[model samples]
Target: MGYLTCKFVRPDKQLFEGKCASMTLVTYSGELGVLPGHASEICALGDGVVRIKRLDEDGGDERDVVVSGGYAEICNDVVVIIADHARAADDIDAETVRRTHDKAQAKRDALPEGDHQRAYYENKMAWCDLLLEKAGAQTASE
Candidate 1:
């Protein structure tokens, strides 16, 4: 079977670089699936989980990461994800995420309805929720 050269990078460093059989990720338009021969295109990424399936000598290996936001580019059977913020599900600190989520939720609740600051806090809480969900899913899969 054909494979894709996948690279995932964050502002601080490259998080992943390898070959994968397939990848699924969230985009601004919606969820997108990329295979070995996917058409070349560029898409704005959304906050969600990115799943990669890799094939090795032994068998298939699946990995997941939480991406806050960014862009994805595909070309010549190569896929690159440049994320604003990303961390492997296994690397996430669940306790830290929970604390941040609680703080953001509390701040949003204290603000008056329709306040602009509330939106910011709401977004932060949502991001934390996504991370927490991904972390839980990873743990359950183990």
Candidate 2:
């Protein structure tokens, strides 16, 4: 099978780099699958899971990463993911994320009845949902 070079980089360091048979990136709009010789494009990523399938690896070798938000660029036989925040499945702390989700939920619940609070809650809920979804997918796939 043909492989395409894939790399994910954040501000701190180079997150990952390798050749893969297929790669999928999660954007606020939806998930996009990329393969060798795929047309180039750019997508706005949301907080969610980035799934990857290595070309020569076995089924058990699939991997996933969680990113807060970022830009995904597909070009020149390469997939470049630059995220605002990111962590691999192994790096995810479910307890920490759960706590954060709880705290956000609490803040949302305690807010006075108003548009401002409502918007805040909505945003918080969105973030929590993304975190939970990514976490769940990561655990299930790994």
Candidate 3:
């Protein structure tokens, strides 16, 4: 295995650069793991947690980020994540997360019966859930 360069970008073009031995991304279809030498591919990432195992320079470095939604691409020796919204674990605000979750729940309740609305709420709920989880809020919605 070799070091994999990871770059996560937000819609505003903010970038978070790091290195990881491996990474796992959650998509609407399923989860995909990337390792060194993996085949080139693109993934439509849904709202969920994007876990990255950063290479520790001293002894150990730990970090995690919650992506609202995005697309991920793996090619050559780099993993590129283009996220519609993203926030680091430490950067998430509790009040805002709660409000967002509440809004998603409201939309879910108002949504009509169909796979499209169901999937939409599901994804929104997923984003709020991940945000609350990463933010250390205890009463996050499932």
Candidate achieving the largest TM-score: 1
lDDT of 2 by residue, 12-125 (tens): 988889888888888998888888888999999887788888766545276788787889899988898898877787776777877887887888778787748768667766
- The predictions' CA RMSDs to the true structure, in order, are 2.5, 3.5, 4.9
lDDT of candidate 3 over 40-80, digit per residue (tens): 99999887777787766623465567776779999996999
Task: Point out the worst 10-residue segment of candidate 2 by lDDT.
Answer: 54-63
TM-score order of candidates, top first: 1, 2, 3
The runs of at least 3 residues in candidate 1 whose Cα sits more than 4 Å from the true structure, single-residue gaps closed, are 104-120
* Span of 10 residues, lowest total lDDT, candidate 1: 55-64
Best by lDDT: 1
The TM-score that candidate 1 achieves is 0.80
111 Cα displacement, candidate 3 (Å): 14
Candidate lDDT scores, in order, read 0.89, 0.80, 0.77
Greater-lDDT candidate between 1 and 2: 1
Question: How far off is residue 94 in model 3, in Å?
Answer: 0.9
